[model samples]
Target: MHNPSSTQVKIVTADPSAIGLFGLAIVTLVASSQKLGLTDGLSLVIPWAIFLGAFAQLFACIHDAKHNNTFGMTAFGAYAFFWFATATSWMVKMGVFGSELAGAVDGKQLGFAFAGYLVFTLFMTIGAMETHKVLFFIFVLIDLLFIGLTFDAFGAPEAFHKLAAFAELGIALLSLYGCGAAVLNTHFGKVFLPVGRPFGIFKARS
Candidate 1:
């Protein structure tokens, strides 16, 4: 009698960073427009915040987790939740969750939140140094963005708000470039766009 044998199958998934960057690009573009006074209200920004900012990055986080990419998972996951919370906060402030919640709003609380994210981004910026120049600069811009946001929330001068607006716009443009590099490089199986080499400061263990 012949015995039956079991076989295991391995699955491969595509890189998720492209989608995550694309999401970041779109949301920041929309939000930065509002910050720069090119747009009117949070009412329009909220939808893109929830859908593209939250959901798209969350999707990337999950897939990165599957790939055992701790860095990608953490970065995408954190930002995804950030957008989710931001969208909800906007809704509450807009009276979508009743006037009681909206009445309790405080700008300083947002300052504290931005401060915390600034710390987070600082360390992440260090990590990005080993990634690639494009990503490293993106993290640097994010650092500037959070710094400006924190100061602006705490009633700093108008210059900080302008700083935040310009930084956010920079992030949007760079992220779009990064997204394009991720996709085109993979699809064409060649370096379609140069993202620059990673800094050789930290080497992987053998």
Candidate 2:
């Protein structure tokens, strides 16, 4: 009989960070289109937010969790929920849920949401700095987007709205970079760009 102890198995998987970076790209592009009025917010924005932003990231989060990649899991999961909430909010605003609920979701409620995302973005920015160039740019743009979003939510002047559009555009561009990096890394099996150690609770498990 063959000795089981003498045999060994090793499984290799793609990088979770790469998957996350790519998802952000698609999410930002669609979000920017909505912000820029290039597409109808109701018809297009809702679907992209739910499908690409929410579902895609959620899928990445599962993989990250399996890898015992705390950084990848939390980062992807939090953003995944963010998109889900954003989609729900949009639906509420559009009266898809009900007129009464739509009326309840006023500017102040949106302001609070913006505030929450601002904090979330800031924390993620720090993590991005530790991740890689593609992710770092995305995080930076996300921080900018939150700033513009918060301002608009607070009933800022029309100028701030314009600023928000620009920020969203920036997000779109950064996301493209992230997407490119993900595809390349997944296929190449090599880190074209070096992303250093994880920050905070981001630890690799054995």
TM per prediction: 0.95, 0.81
Compute the lDDT of residue 189 as modeled in candidate 1. 97
Model 1: number of backbone collisions: 0
lDDT of 2 by residue, 37-138 (tens): 787656677777788788888988988888888877988898899889888888888899888998887777777888888898788787776666557766
Model 1: per-residue lDDT, tens digit, 47-113? 9999999999999999999999999999999999999999998999999999999999998999999
Q: Pick the candidate with the highest lDDT.
A: 1
lDDT for 121 in candidate 1 is 97
Per-structure clash totals for the candidates = 0, 1
lDDT for each candidate structure: 0.96, 0.74
| Span of ten consecutive residues with least summed lDDT in model 2 | 197-206
Give the residue spans of candidate 1 off by over 4 A. Answer: 1-6, 204-206
Alpha carbon lDDT of residue 38, candidate 1? 99
